[model samples]
Target: MQAASFTGILKAIFYMIAFYYIFRFLAKLFLPLLVKKVVEKAGQKFQQQQQHSQENPWNKTTAKDEVIYNTANTKNPRETKKVGEYVDYEEID
Candidate 1:
């Protein structure tokens, strides 16, 4: 490959600096709008959840039922279901 001249090196440095500043300027201009949109979406979701929880008492009860069911089933369920069987093994050398 041919050697890079001083002018070529200076042009490359100038192009890199130009791109860096352009990126920084664009980010500064758009980052706030992006953050605002995300915050608005989260706020809307929070309000929806609040409205749902307020409207549906059964929804809250179902969540509690799930917690209770999980804990109760692991220990002593009302209707027992066999999951697995114990096996006895002997090793000989």
Candidate 2:
């Protein structure tokens, strides 16, 4: 069996550090582009939804479809009823 050597351990550490820096560099270059594309797609979807809402017929209100509620003739249904008599108790210390 071949025992681990100092050079082999150093080579492994170097490879790990190189891989980390390379990944960081690539992410810095491409991450913004990926995020920009996502944001633009979301903005387009939001604009489409706004346009759809504006063009919908049910969202428009007209004079004939207006509703008015008369509250003056309404009766109050929440008349309070007594359930039990209150009993006061003195604290004995």
Residues 1-93, model 1: lDDT tens digits? 999999999999999999999999999999999999999999999999999878986545443454344575678657777999999999998
Query: What is candidate 2's lDDT per residue for 13-78, written digit by digit as tens?
Result: 999999999999999999999999999999999999999988896757666776788776576556
In angstroms, give how far residue 85 of model 2 lies from its true place. 9.4
Report backbone clashes per prediction. Answer: 0, 0
lDDT minimum window of 10 residues, candidate 1: 61-70
Report residue 20 deviation for candidate 2 (angstroms). 0.8
What TM-score against the true fold does each predicted structure earn? 0.58, 0.63
Question: What local distance difference test score does each model get?
Answer: 0.89, 0.92
Residue pairs in steric clash, candidate 2?
none
Error of 1 at 82 (Å): 35
